[model samples]
Target chain A: MEENNENMTFENSSLAENTAVTAAAVENTENLNAAVENAPDTNAAMENSSAGSPAETDEEQKKPYRKIPKGLLWRCWFIFCFFQRTCQCFDRAYCNAFTYGIMPILRYLYKGREDEDEQIHAGLMRTRNYYLCEQSFSTVVFAIIIGMEEQKANGADISDELIMATKTSIMGPLSGLGDAIHGSTFRQIAIALTIPYCLEGSIVGALLMLIGMNITPWLTTLIGFPQGYKLGSEFVLKLLQSGKMQKAASAAGLMSMFIMGGMAAKYANITLSLTFKNDYKEIKIQDMLDNAIPGLLTIGAVFGFYGLIQKKVSTNKLILGTMAIGIALSACHAMGY
Target chain B: MSSTGITLLVAFILACYYGFYSTYPFMILMGPAGMGSIIGLIIGLIMGDPVKGIEVGALIQTMYMGVVGYGGVLPVDQFFACIIAIPLAISSGMSNESALALAAGFGALGVMIDTLWKTINTSVWTPYIDRACEKNQYRKIAKGAGLYPILTRMAISVPIITVLLFLGSTAVNWLMDNLPEWLQVGFNNMGTILPAMGFAMFVSYIGKKELIPFFIIGFYVMKFASLPIIGMAIFGAFIAWLVAKTDKSSDTEGGLA
Candidate 1:
């Protein structure tokens, strides 16, 4: 039994080494294609390369074992994509670390080899470093990217230590970017756009916001998986530095601001009911303000809240303050003052 | 069926489903069902009054808009609040503004229950998952990861929601009948003021000085033109796209220099 175990280990290492060489070759060709595709005048070359790649054809014929089955790919996608916030215990030691970051790769790697208990245990431990981070918009996107790279390296010569290290290093920056763009900007825009519709009791607005918020993460998983598997983390860094992410975020931010302004005017209902009994006519404060500057009170209320926030007032405090002021004013109005 | 009975039945089901979905499993459905607007729509359908249901839902939703559970700290329990307050309000003939106030107050209290749930989950179920992984029982690990947390959540949430629904309607009716008019008016005022707070929270999250002008533009357009909110949003999108185009061109020029 001992001799047989040794022989198995030897065979596995050699197979992995051979697979690594093939992966490197595939990576090089892909990088060249990507570079050409990015240039302005290489549209035709890009089309030709995509349509019929010599390297791809050679890889398909020679390295059949390297190809992940379609069913398995989809199953992996489903597990990692939806189970993003699983395992969020108090410690958060693996904060979606297992379900989102590691489980998909484990499933793909251990597909037909589930009997290898030792290998499974080893894989779990190796992937089980501190994986806690904020739940940003890109959380799932980064998880898919990292999981795909692990799947790509399953039979290759990459060490478990190296894979673990790569995951830890990338999560911080990716989450930061995602938080700024997806969490804060995109989500706000979705809310701003949909709130009006929701206020008017339109289900269409709710559906549109749900779809709009999900599209990016959905597309990221679909596209990031294959690309990460083929080119690894290099692709992720390049994608970030390309400036497209920033541009998209800025556009969304600008749009969100505009919609919020409109939302304030339409929804933030504040009117002065105070009227003065003069000799000739009773003067209504709200109507006069409206005639002078439409939405004056709404704008003022928004700025007032903004000023409180700038003064470092907590959200709870601000909520209570608004409520107190509103009630006080309403009571005064009720007295017909 | 009596209004209270109908409310109890619907609230119980919504609570059970919400507890399960909020955790690990069935997250896809959670998105739409989780929102106050959708919950209101569902309540409306159950009560055979979609219009009033929607109005109440929209009012309640604005209070909790842009609020999310980040880093395991649930600021408010929107699900619990909606389940308890919506049904009771609808059944008791409470005004939408009063319903909003009730829901917001319940949402704040529900935060404690949420914390307790998370604490139990961390201490009890998580260790089981760790042990299962160590034994290399992948199927057990899967169950521990997904099923256990959900069951635990439902166990706590279902009974509490059931009790709330059964008793909540009567309680609301009593309060409405006996409460002083001044306090009632205060609660109604909260319905209007709470949305302002929600908008303020959103601004604090994403506001930048450079973007303040766009907000003013949006406000005036809506106030003066009387265009629908959706129409204003489309116009905002166009302006954003134009701004992005110009910004990109300027960036390229700077790079060349």
Candidate 2:
């Protein structure tokens, strides 16, 4: 097990159970050592093998294993794809993480520490898969969480197809989320206003962003983590105290929607164009639309077709329809419409 | 558009990188937080996981992000709704009102649906995910390469953008003519009500019970301090951070007052 640990950067817990496995050392984040602090993270392998709970049950539920039958993936890929296709207006996470992060977390939580090399490998692979494919931020967390869980469980052999299916399923929704959060809102709010100040070369904006976006999120996550931990610890107690999961989902949903609605009103813009009608003649319709309507219209179009393409409308047809609209609009602009 | 304008526009577009071109179909099918495509992607990258993190991250993000139009101010866009998840929804198509509705209704649904799906998956598939928990490096590689959804979207977006580019101006007129009444009213109402809602949510979510001090701090910065928008926001965040760092017990109280 120690030999395997040396060969792999992945976190597997069989070393503790085996006892022969070398304990990978944790960077004593708490140890106040300034000199000779080059201690290796080697003991972590051994310590983790024994203290392996982090590998498992650190988070919530996950997607079904490939080996499992009659689950959501096979039974309802199409249904699930509704959110996958339309995760543009808002940033999504729980479901994607469930399939990716939750999977391994569960695996690790339920099973005893053993060789879970296959599962961890699969989870990480799926995580990277969607980053390029769709560009979501949740994908990595989903995979690691799943990997951690799977490592916790002794780890049973799961098939490639199921894991792949989970990986592929999450790619697009996650990417869209990635674009909206860091790409649009975070980037825009964090830096859009700050860039001018920073561009004029003020370190103020840069520092402001550091605190606004980076520090804010980090702080939120720090607080959130413990809240989540407390929730996890009292899972059964909370369940009994709170009654069914449905009520909680309902409250959370209403709260989430209320928040989402507020965002659309404030940030999603697509106002009319401003231009002179000469060499720069009147602004092109595209410019006109962008300036006049803001981008909310674009969001509308995506949502309008979400139900259609997600189920009945084919991908081919959707693209075809979009092109037809784009061309027609482009032509109108060209022809002075 | 001038070449310069187009260049600038392109840079902006790249920076924002709307996720619809890549993830719509699968999201619509999957019903994760439909709005969380971008966040899911970021969470994925941050976690070194990608889409899977998106699956889970979307749920988490829905709490922090959203869409509100008119006079309302939102912390983020609410693209989680189903209508917005469709291809080209937020691209060059649809009306402002429609987009707002799509984002609002569908984004809300996305959160609900994602929660629903997870609840079911948890109940049904726990044993399965449990089995395959150990494999790591390999899974990450596979997760990175996975592109079925993108391929699927590309297959669709290409035609849509191409066709729309040449379809003519009548489409725009038709779209304008067809604007719905409920939507108009909703947008108007939103303009009036949303600001209150957004600020209130910030107070509620951030405040929980600590509203007075946060509001006082926010008010001080907004009024007396009169810092720039970004500065004021940072000050608010700083205050929030200190408050956040407060012991859970302290945080729960309304305030010293």
Candidate 3:
């Protein structure tokens, strides 16, 4: 399961294309014919329809390539940011959000074309497939895809398969790292750092926590989008391969581990009530554990659950199990065990 | 301000909070530590006890530290727990244990509500998007995808949370009041123990065997020296930097060889 999920990449474009053709035929055959005629070739036309106006794509191809406008890039960033989780469906997952977010860029690329609608409709339908990843860190993927769209608009040899493959291949590894860094580690560090202050009756704790939580995601999006667009997908692949990404992830992990230890020590306060009567006096287990280590129970709880998690125990099960153990211990205490 | 006005104000805050929750900038307000604390503090101030609000908020935040919306599956809805529990804690003078129990229990319910919201988006709004896409209506697709999901969630969550706040707060207090003493103690103990799960979840995701020593070092240091969290974080950062630097040099050497 882990192996399968780690390298997961969905690519069934032929299926999508077939359905799209049928859907388009049923909806409006005349419009589809107009789109095909305006298109340079059927394949280029199909790819072209998803972006820039196919009619003008030839003219735009002749003109000098202009760098995508700063305003357009900004619009792309904000749209994705705002609508990344929009209209999530059972079928397509994040496809709706992707389509919605990239609309501006698509329109810009396909601008002033006779078959602009058909082209955009094609583009939107192409992205209408399974896509799930850490939202903020997904800026890089969106940027790269936009770059591909721009290139395709300018008559690059980019295929729909290439674009879809890029989206699928990159998103998985990125999501894995993103989930670890932004989703888990960074969030824990923020909470750990701010919780103490929060417990102390200071709004600073809450304020710092908000700042801590927001900064990584905001900065990642801010930096990732522009850099991703400039460097393109090849650069991201290079970064992934260089092992620098691993080193950086490890560094972040190390910090998170240290903080987790500190947090567990300070916060986890489960106490045991087990005792044995030896006639002289009842020997208490909690004291013995404390004598061995101050927060032994807490550490034990952490590692025990960690082991369970590594063994693929679902989080909900672990949560229930922890609650059950806590309840049982309470019952033991009630029974004077 | 009148209690009614305060209730209305809280309702508005919660409405905005949950409505734009998945939207960016608004997404920043999604975390328990961030928005949860703010909401707690706001409700606390409204109740003439900002400190209590902060404390309760912090507690919820701490418990939910490692909870992530991984693959869009939230095992527990800490945000929902926060909105419900903070108000209950402040208004009904509920015990922290009871408040936590309410948070945990209702948190499960919150997940169901979240699923329902997503389902509604899929079922109700998605068809419009598909139709819009087929007909080449860009504006309709944008509105369907971007605007409708949020507004729909607002429509669903706002009324439900607001009603829960006004009516459910006292009712939950009553329920907690009636729970057996042992169960209450069990819940209190559960609250204490739950944060361990947070840390455990934190480590399980990020932990590597090579970094195990850092965890040990961090634990023992905190046990003996009891350094503040910020100080520990700084120390950890320094160690991480050193380790990364050393590892990079070794990698280069390995490549050269």
What are the Cα lDDT values of the candidates?
A: 0.62, 0.33, 0.68
Total clashing pairs for each candidate: 0, 217, 5
Best by lDDT: 3
Q: What C-alpha lDDT, on a 0 to 100 scale, does residue B185 get in candidate 2?
A: 42
Of 1 and 2, the candidate ahead on DockQ is 1
The interface root-mean-square deviations, each candidate in sequence, come to 3.7, 15.4, 3.3
lDDT of 2 by residue, B14-122 (tens): 2223334234333211112222433334323433434333333232232232232211112233433322322222233344333333334334433443344333333
RMSD per prediction, one decimal? 9.1, 18.1, 9.7
* Model 2 regions lying over 4 Å from their true place: A1-337, B1-145, B152-189, B216-227, B230-257
Leading candidate by TM-score? 3
Tens digit per residue, CA lDDT, model 2, A1-337: 4454453323223323222211112122121121112111223422345333465434322423222122422222223222332222222222332344243343444343343455444443343222222222333323322333343333333334334443343333333333333333343344334433432323344345344444333432334333322222111122222323322222222232222223333332222222347764564556655555444453344244444533545322443343344334334333112
Clashing pairs in 3: A49-A119, A50-A123, A52-A109, A52-A110, A53-A110
On TM-score, the stronger of 1 and 2 is: 1
TM per model? 0.79, 0.33, 0.81
Question: What DockQ does every candidate get?
Answer: 0.46, 0.07, 0.45
lDDT accuracy of residue A31 in candidate 3: 31
Give per-residue CA lDDT, model 1, range A38-76, as digits (tens).
221222222232333565666435434434566666665
